[model samples]
Target chain A: MINAVKREIPEFIEGYGKVKPFMGAYANIGDVVKTSVKIKSVKPNDKKVLPSIKDALLKCGIKDGMTISFHHHLRNGDYVLNMVLDEIAKLGIKNLTVAASSIFPCHAPLVEHIKNGVVTKIYANYMSGPVAEAVSKGLLKYPAIMHTHGGRARAIESGDLHIDIAFIAAPTCDTYGNINGVEGKSACGSLGYAIPDAMYAEKVVAITDNLVDYPACPIEISQEYVDYVVVVDEIGDPKGIVSGTTRITRDPIGLRIAKLAAQLIDEVGLLKDGFSFQTGAGGTSLAVAAFVKDIMKKKNIKGSFAAGGITGYIVDMFEEGLFKALFDVQCFDLKAVESYKNNKAHQGMSASMYGNPHNKGAVVNNLDVMILGATEVDIDFNVNVTTGSNGIIIGGSGGHSDTAAGAKLAIVVTQLTKARLPIIVDRVTTVTTPGETIDAVVTERGIAINPRRQDLLEKLKDSNLPIFTIEELKNMAEKLTGVPEKIEFEDRIVAVVEYRDGTVIDVVRQVR
Target chain B: MKIVRPAKAGTMESNDIYIMVYPNENGNEIQLDSIVLKQFGNQIKKVIMDTLNELEVENALVVAKDRGALDYTIKARVETAIKRACE
Candidate 1:
């Protein structure tokens, strides 16, 4: 089967079971059934507290070949994934599949477990570090599964992916398993990624450093979903969980790209009242927010909302009355965490509500503009944020394609060439976000509007910025760097890159 | 021309290169290390040697630590180090 992006897909992957080719941006839709269910009978006197992770594993009836789940709100500072996996490895548990929301550098130890056969399969939204490298080298027996934030939720809800137990890393939790992300030393702002796991997992164990009195304040994951609570020494490092401040780009080229992106938004007339925006936490994307802030302030345009992983810059904009509200699925920095904790306008949204296409309505669907980053953008406008020029998996489409599919304008802001390699290529190594959804590409050299967006081209025609066709940009980049040699890869699929609609967009082969 | 003094340039940040140039009597030798060596090592090393050849530096010890910096950035940082070495 071939997906919308023209990537071939087998009917079945060894570990992942079935492959679904993306029909279209909105063509894939069906009735989503909630498959996870647990026996409700319980004793009133039953103590939900567990002595340690081992005890929690014992109590949860964790066994070989069962699918265990985790959330990555802790980002790189997470202690829960390693701690839990270490206990499982110690217990000699084998063939356990891990369904984590995202995998980070701190979870690199899982590479050893994968080698040891303690863990066999991985399902994640995003992944980086040593494990990703190992997977790219074909270390795992089966290719890993990558899903979008919303796609993962949809898969879990639709019974495509089932978890036997879910280990949730909570900042604060009560005796009865009421949890919130804003009360403890490791406060991470929002447990949005963990909410669906808690609600749908057959058994949920709330792992926390701060075990407070019953009824944890502002419960993000209510007691109804939680089955057990385990107290750990530390859930995560707060400093690592959220950076103290996520500043804008200092690089002149990055600033220029951001300036053009902001100007494009203003020219498109989406900078007026009730406009909603979403961007990444990258330096350049944050700089776009800063540049857009000046425009909003100058024009007195109060936007309807700001969405995705909330940053301090967006929080500041919201506080200054630039936006009416903030819909945050996760907090990327300390200021965002603080704002989510105190401000009424700063609301936490579940992954489903954030961008689940299967859901009734997503915040991204209401988004006016989204600023995104890319490792490569092809002549077709297909963006690759998943792999490097060397074809190694460095990132995944967390919300990259989701918001692109939803937003009125999806602008990919990146340098023309990164590390001597042309970013505007004839074909991207992997297609994470299809070009059909992307409206434009903003680089330091020039801005290239997608040929499909005639409306946008007409509006930006009078603008003073250098506007070129994507092919011209590609030529210009090639002329500067000369054409790069083709990267060679072995004939083994290391990982399958899934589109936002849960289809195979590309497959990363073994990098020799 | 020989480098009169030891000079260093660039940063340790990802996608950036850090270089140190020292006056060496042995010969012009470039020592390079990089994270993306398996993928872009050849290109990175070529950029370093090209910059050195362009500048006509014949007696310097060039040690470069790369974090996946591109050719243009490497050239700029190398040029900066050479100018600093002469200063």
Candidate 2:
């Protein structure tokens, strides 16, 4: 079956089961009836604190084939997922599905679990490192489900994802199960990604390095949702959890593309008062934000809010009064964590409210512009952040599709060519974000406004910045780097790339 | 040009090719590892083989690690390696 993006998908994927081909960007719109989780009571005399993860697992009645969930607030620093999985393997559990928000290089042990049949299936928003490479080689028993950040939250809330147990790596937690990301040694800010898991999972376990006194102040996930609190020697490494500061790109081409994108946004009249923006943590994206800062500061434009993963640069922008408030789904750096703790303006928002299309209104809907990075952008404007030209899983769409669909002006900034390969291709290796949702693509060669965005095209016609059609840009890039040889893949599917609306946009095949 | 001792040219960097040439008993042995192996692998190998042919590099072992180098860069690196190996 062909999805709306024109990618051929099997009606029933071997390991993924039935396919729901994406019809359109807003195809899944309907009144959602949220499912309720099983309720449990904690008596005043009863205790929630546990001695070890094994105790919490036994207390939760965890069994083989149960779906367990984890959040990526600790990022590369996270040890809880591996720590618990090691215990689970020791207990000899089989066929368990790990529904983690994201997977990093630190989760390479997951590859071993996939090989030994301890973990049969996996779900994540983004993936990288050895586990991703192993998945691309068809190591997992089932096809990996790569959902967007918003889609993961939706899947949990809508009951599509039934997490039997959720293990949240809390930076700070009380003996009674109150939890927060701040005020601890690990101290990863914004426990936003873990909220839905805590709210929807059958049994919520709070794994913390810092076990404070009862009634832990600044409770992000209150004690009511947590069933067990386990104190560990360490939940995560502070150095890996948060960076000192994220720097803008120093590459000349990257800076040029960023400049062009920022100029395009300003040209479209979106850089004025009350402007809201979102950008990823990529060097180019950060550079675009830096360029936008200059424009905002020059005109004394007081913007509304900056949304998505909060970074130190964004925190500085908010502190400088460039933006009125910040909507944080995750903290990328330590300064942002500090801002979240002290400043009331740096708000913590759940993954659901951040970009879930089914929600009443998400923070992304209020975004005036969103600058993104792409591994490849096809002539149709469809972006691929999921796979490389060789059709291997390098990364996944964490919030790429969600913010692109919601923002008024979704701009993708990239160098026209990369390492003798063009960033713009005749067709992307995979479609992570469909073209209909993308408004523009900015490359060092020129800026191409999506033909569908005629309003932007007409507005930018008179601008000084170089503007070209996507076809023209592709043609120029191909001139430098001739059309690449087509990549071959095995018949067996490796992963399913789901759109934010819970439909299959594309499927990745095992690399031959 | 007759091959003498083992010699190398180019750095392992983006848009660059690292070429190593050694004297061999057989005609030509070429081994390549490239970033653009999926796409331009055939083109890159052809360029190296053609460049070796032009230099009359018979009975030599050629190894190249390419990080998406252009045709001229690949040719230049191969030529430089051939020159250095002969001296």
Candidate 3:
């Protein structure tokens, strides 16, 4: 029984606060179970078609004040969340709680539902755009509960968040509910974010635009967990799955930054065979991959694997035999989705399996190098990707700190300045990734090795790349462009920035 | 494509500056009085000069009201302005 809870046992035991079991209570458990009446499984009738979403909700016993869940695999393209909530609103459901993986700008429709008293509570890994703006304004009746990607998984598994119905937007699903993200027209890549939701929800509904024959290949979410299958005209738009401009930087400054990052990795002796690397699909980070690819080709060395949100460029490297395998938590583009469908070596990984620190051996633990982006990097190497200079919540730490903390070498690639604002500051607006995890900071001007990494500093001493202390880099930037004016922020905290390990790193405030 | 003539210019000095405005095809124009443009002059000059240097062009004055123009879009407008100046 304790093993079922696993990592959560300690918390549960703490919450119990000295409830001691009787001495003979444990001994009689087996005999008591044997004397109890046995119940057989009653499968649903085969001839009945799954009802409409509204009818399905009624059948699933959905009522006011119940919590419903949605996955964010479709990201900005997702239409299911709003559509379902619209139906729920029409039904006059009030005080309902929405537990979604993450909420994007496209989820602005939800603000109306919140205003109409349909949704009173919300829980998500991240929130941005108008939804965030609405939350900041304190429009909702309840304060939104924010969790990290790993934290959400832990919460669901521990039964802390008991979801009544999980509305999973499957890119592809069979009538029997064997679903995968790789097959359908709306293939957005791996159905990683939905795995935990489906497993823990009392009733799981698989909504898909594409209904395949009998059994879908590569069952990401199995039929055993799914209770209902509903086919719709469209689940999501594939184009919105991958943002435009996931290309290498053509700008000289951005290229220089990428080159510096790649050289720093090589200088640290991490470019040899059997190495593993992970980089975000950002432009500068993709440029780093391009440079690393060239160096690997020139040296004729192959990597063990490349992990994280897989892009077509990484898929191309896999096809070129540069890496042994690609461990993809999510697919970021059409090519990656296609490769995920056909390629035997490409494997999908769940969020828990990818970055959960409590896990025995997550994929991030084996990463040799990880290139990340930052909105602001302090002299201490603490990186902030969550807020802008004005303390406005512009972005969220989506695996930035997770990969940085787990990887052997974490390199932060950023331009020295953006839109006349210096990115290297005395203190970051928010600390998403702590300084201890970050090894080096690469900028268009120069590279800065963290003082803690004496080994890396010694190794790169003779390298051609210009290396400077972080303070020195800041001073140089100030010399080139006069000291930037500090932004004034209001007293009210807009949002709390959460570290991947579920700690509150910092809070963002509205710009004054 | 309404191309307004460059404002009658004085010598390019610290104080004297030429402002060229090009309205979009939709005829959407953002008004910028001399005072507002002067406030943003230094930063705008740096950005335009840096882009011109990067693109290897010279002798252009660009005034743009970006509704939602990207970085590359800004560069293209500057380049077109430079070509017009040369002609």
Which structure among the candidates has the greatest lDDT? 2
Q: What does candidate 2's lDDT look like per residue over A1-512, in tens digits?
A: 88888899999987677889999998887899788889688788999988999999999998999999999999998899999999999999999999999999999998899999999999999999999999999999999999999998889999988899999999999998999888989999899999999999999999998999988989999999999999889998888898888999999999998998888888999999999999988899999999999999999999999999999999999999999999998999999999999999899999999988887988888999999889999989999999998889999999999999999999998999999998998899999999999999999989888999888878877788888889999999988878889999998898999998889999999999
Question: DockQ for model 1?
Answer: 0.26
- Across residues A370-415, which tens digit of lDDT does each residue of candidate 1 receive? 9999999998899998888888889898988889999999999999
Q: Which residue pairs clash in candidate 3?
A: none
On lDDT, who's better, 2 or 3?
A: 2
- Per-model i-RMS: 3.2, 0.8, 10.5
In model 2, the Cα lDDT at residue A423 comes to: 91
What is the fnat of model 2 with respect to the true interface contacts?
Answer: 0.81
Models ranked on TM-score: 2, 1, 3
Chain B TM-score (each prediction, in order): 0.93, 0.96, 0.39
Alpha-carbon deviation at A270 in model 1, angstroms:
0.5
* Model 1 stretches astray by more than 4 angstroms: B1-87
DockQ of each: 0.26, 0.83, 0.05
Q: Which portions of model 3 show Cα errors greater than 4 Å? A: A1-49, A141-146, A243-245, B1-87
| Candidate 2: Cα lDDT at A173 | 95
TM-score of chain A of 3: 0.87
lDDT of 3 by residue, A1-512 (tens): 12110111121122112212211101211211101211222366652137577877876788999999998888888889988888888888899989988888989999999888898888777778888777666566665655666556655765656788999998889888888988777888788878888877888888889988878878999987877888888887666666543577788888889988888888789999998999988888998999999999999999999999898999988999899999987888888888888888998888777776655557888999999898888887888776666555556666776788789999999888665456788877766667878899999888998898999989987888889899988887565545655656665544544455443455555556
